[model samples]
Target: MDFREYQRRARETDQTPDTDGDGLIVPLLGMAGEVGTLLADYKKRLRDRDTYRLFKESIAEELGDILWYVANLATKLDLDLDDIAAFNLRKTRERWLHVGEKQGRLPFYLLFDEQFPPEEQLPRKFSVKFSQEKQGSGATVVLTWDGQTIGNRLTDNAYVDDGYRFHDVFHLSYAALLGWSPVTRKLMQRKRKSNPKVDEVEDGGRAGVTEEGISAYVFSYAKDHSFLRNVGALDYELLRTIKRLTASFEVNIRSPADWERAILAGYQVWRKMRESEGGTVHLDLVNRTIAYSSE
Candidate 1:
């Protein structure tokens, strides 16, 4: 039967549908128990090996119980199962599709500075040179573009050199992969001053700080995962947190797949830059890539 019909019939048997805090626990606990039971049944089948004669039917029965509890909980909360299923599919589709892997459709990319003058927009292509200098016991990264020094020298500022000094690569990746970076706008003098509201809200200090927060947040996650070395996919909840963080800005239009690419590419360049002590990072917006050049 269809999900809607099954949902409607499922609730008919839900005796505890009071919609109160305590009443909600019935279905919630039921779902958890059924999941546990399903796994336990599988364990028994594996233990019994070929002697597990009714394994298929037993597993199906447990799944039906789980589905009933899930439907009953949704009904209690006044939700439609079919709508929920559709929404979940949409979310997973957007999250799983790789940046360059779509078969027939190009991923949507938004460039917030499209209407602005050339100088006022991020350079479609440019190279930022990072030169590391020694300061007694610490190191500082001098950032330069077009033979002119841009931002101040960066140091880890931590008790140990944890590579936080290379975090700026994350911002550069956002500029290259997602075409949005408040920090880049401020550094390159590309803020949307022609529109005061956009300047204040989109390319302002708070937005720059928000970008930095994302860089720091993702860095922490990367550190525990070997700096994302040889990793293929990112944690879904981590990407969801980034969405909530940037929901107020234009960059929010970028999908989780875009953010994942940005984060991974940034870390890849950062690793090379760190190993080489310093290097020139090339950003190509037209191709959506960031590459490190030791030369």
Candidate 2:
């Protein structure tokens, strides 16, 4: 079905009456939880080599639930899922294809130690981290014991010399939605010039604009849309917080040592906010080839 159809079904499933004691945050958070769960399940099936049709179907079903709730939340807030989707597609295009001198793209470094050798072996812990001190922020990823890190391959010529980071778009989008000053945009423009491939560039594609162009446009358009004013106003704090976090993460992409410190600190903050409820912790930074564990 189309985007609106997905949203309509989502609202039918997740939303309650205007006075049924349900608000926006509850369902959004629920959706986030389900997405995490679905991801976990998908990994399990992949590790077990249980890639049967039924397993795939089950994973897809759970993913649908996640998407439904996400749509419901967006609809409730008068947000456009299509717009978000479009923007995200553009960002992905830029990051994977257009950004920087391809060589600047982050390097992939997979590990296959005896403890967490491969999917065939009993799982220990596997993680991937991507960071850039030049961009000022980084991420630390932690995997479950059943996870394996493999095939850190680069198929594109663009990921060669320098390091590139694209998360500033999060802050830029958030800032635009709130009618914040254009400082973020100016910064982004500078960042794009310096790293060429990360920022949205004009191109033609399936739709009128290239998918990335649409993302860049929606980011500006959504802010100007009158119906979104209320929703944007309400989400001001969340956006602002995201912008700050993005800025904080992007500040450490300079050197490996610097990236390591910045990424760990950011990961700690992220764990506190996003994954603190869970017990197991394993964050591995690929470029640095270091793993941090907490039990």
Candidate 3:
């Protein structure tokens, strides 16, 4: 099954809305406890030089629980597991190796003059592949942060920190790709100023535009912008649809701490605008105007 089907099924049965307020935390913690117990057993078995059958079985079961909780958390966050997995792989590649470079640096081995290992020779990582032969044919989503690379292995501590960093990076990158209004950002500033603890202040009357006015102004500016017009020239219909989307007055963004939230909401608006007319064609992040992107 494709991602949509996986998500639909996860929503229907696999996830529970346990209202203790911790959501997936409780389940995840329980899984962690199980892993801890398995690790203890494995240590004892290794020390005694005894058969480790029970230890391996216990470890496998706890890991399965951890995977389930991870999927549950991803669903609650409105993220696709496969997309997260793929993005992680791409990021790992980028961080450790240059795109065109043959030999890349692992945490330990620095092989600047050698070629990258063939797939078979490369160290095995936690592979997540959508198995066509699985019951539902779900796409494989592998994890390989702990796997050895070249001659060095990523430490557990480093792996966890890197994962969270990648998650934050994804959030920021996605926000930049979607265009959010400047006025919404200003409202966020208003929220910061109104707080008693925040002493740094800007002049009054800033970030005061109504949602309707901003939307209209944005549409008008986009329609008149010379660069946008030329880039969107091939598809005049796209320009027309964007104009209509901005015509709606149902703005979702309301405050400053809501900057990331607002970007997501704006993307939703843009999605509907595309779907209402037909397919989501003729969309480009290049036309977006963001100050940081000036470089």
> For each candidate, what TM-score against the reference?
0.92, 0.32, 0.30
RMSD of 3: 26.8
Candidate with best lDDT? 1
Tens digits of per-residue lDDT, candidate 1, 1-295, equal: 9999999999889788799886699989988998898888889888998898888898899899989988988998999999999999878877986644656434656577888878778998999988999899989988888888887789997998987877788899999999989998887778888889999999999999999999989988998999999988899999999999999999888889889988999999999998999999999887788999997
Tens digits of per-residue lDDT for model 3, 159-249 = 2211111111122222233333223223222123333332122112221233334344333443354313223122334333433443432
Candidate 2 residues 259-279, lDDT tens each? 222233333333332323223
What ranges in model 3 sit over 4 Å off? 1-15, 18-20, 98-295
Candidates sorted by lDDT, descending order?
1, 2, 3
Local distance difference test, candidate 3 = 0.35
Badly placed stretches (over 4 Å) of model 1 are: 50-53, 99-108
Among all windows of ten consecutive residues in candidate 2, which has the lowest summed lDDT? Answer: 202-211
lDDT of 1: 0.88
Best by TM-score: 1
Model 2 CA RMSD to the hidden true structure, in angstroms: 21.8
Give the range of the ten consecutive residues with the poorest summed lDDT in model 1: 99-108
